[model samples]
Target chain A: DAGITQSPRYKITETGRQVTLMCHQTWSHSYMFWYRQDLGHGLRLIYYSAAADITDKGEVPDGYVVSRSKTENFPLTLESATRSQTSVYFCASSPGTGAGPQHFGDGTRLSIL
Target chain B: QQQVKQSPQSLIVQKGGISIINCAYENTAFDYFPWYQQFPGKGPALLIAIRPDVSEKKEGRFTISFNKSAKQFSLHIMDSQPGDSATYFCAARTNDMRFGAGTRLTVKP
Candidate 1:
């Protein structure tokens, strides 16, 4: 079904450069989220959108920007990326919050050099 | 509280054995507790989940035990298998959400 897909499955960027990770879902879920996974921190939410054009900050939103121009697409942009931003980024979506389970993407392994 | 605490940073179990992972939270408003399994190079996928109103829920070889009063929950894998080996994360969802540091599980055949 290609339920959820994330692009640039692997990315390597230099510090201070802008990098964007793409996420798309075919289910047309109402809630989409961006999370970064680190060794000791587990998964930390970066940004979330309730629906198109309705976005909110998450636990770890610094240095990252997100927009849901369409219900199926939510992209995360790391402005002036830093080494600290290097982590496995996961995109997830749920039919609704606290009610339905979130489906996750394979994730994008981003390396900020 | 927004924190969800998990124990045993890692676990090893033999096939046909039982594997359990525990998580505790401080928020009483959290009604949804879910466990996710993540393989290397992949995203975390829902393994099992439970609601506070229910004390336990089971699916196939996986089960979730919830203790609302204690603000704790756990995932139990019966008849552990090698394919079940993965990093497990416990998450509590309220109006806001938080996740526990994952536990890496290794099942030996």
Candidate 2:
């Protein structure tokens, strides 16, 4: 497709297990971000990548790890998924890290049991 | 403190009526303001956006009114339709984007 896509639209994993959410964008945007959305909290950024190998922590980065080996893919990994980590995960990308509009993927609904 | 605050956690309006959602921010450095619309089980999509330089921007039936001095902005939908029913989020961005808690709007036909 021409836009961003997220894998495993729905996922259920046990606590303490590792889970990875994948995000791929066809636009080859330079900036990619991962956000977790929960009730009362609109969208909290977990991590963002400026370029292929440059990444930074966002508002809520604890327990989540992100890596961008290529411009088109930004994957978020939960080393030890906890029940508190159960939330809808969204992946977005923009042309650059500056003041630009972001295109969001459908999102991955992760449920930790 | 919430960087961006949105009012009216929920709203209901009849078809063809106007729907208004308000948002305010504390940061003056925010140069870009964008609104996002989200449906249940879906990611948010950019509805409209405006810069601090302009007081208002309109696209189709959606309009964004910005007040730089007051650090506030609002989204007004003219002749709102049932299809427009969704959760709307107001966001401000300088280098990083921060979104409001969100407002759920339901338009009944």
Top candidate on DockQ is 2
As a whole number from 0 to 100, the lDDT of residue A62 in candidate 2 is: 97
lDDT of 1 by residue, A2-45 (tens): 69999999999999999999999999899999998888787888
Model 1: CA > 4 A from native:
none
How much TM-score does chain B earn in each model?
Answer: 0.96, 0.98
- Residue B107 accuracy (lDDT) in model 1: 99
For candidate 2, write residues B21-97 as lDDT tens digits: 99999988898899999998788998899999999999999999999888899999999999999999998887678
Interface RMSD of each: 1.9, 1.3
Error of 2 at A34 (Å): 0.5
Candidate 2's displacement at residue A79, Å, is: 0.6
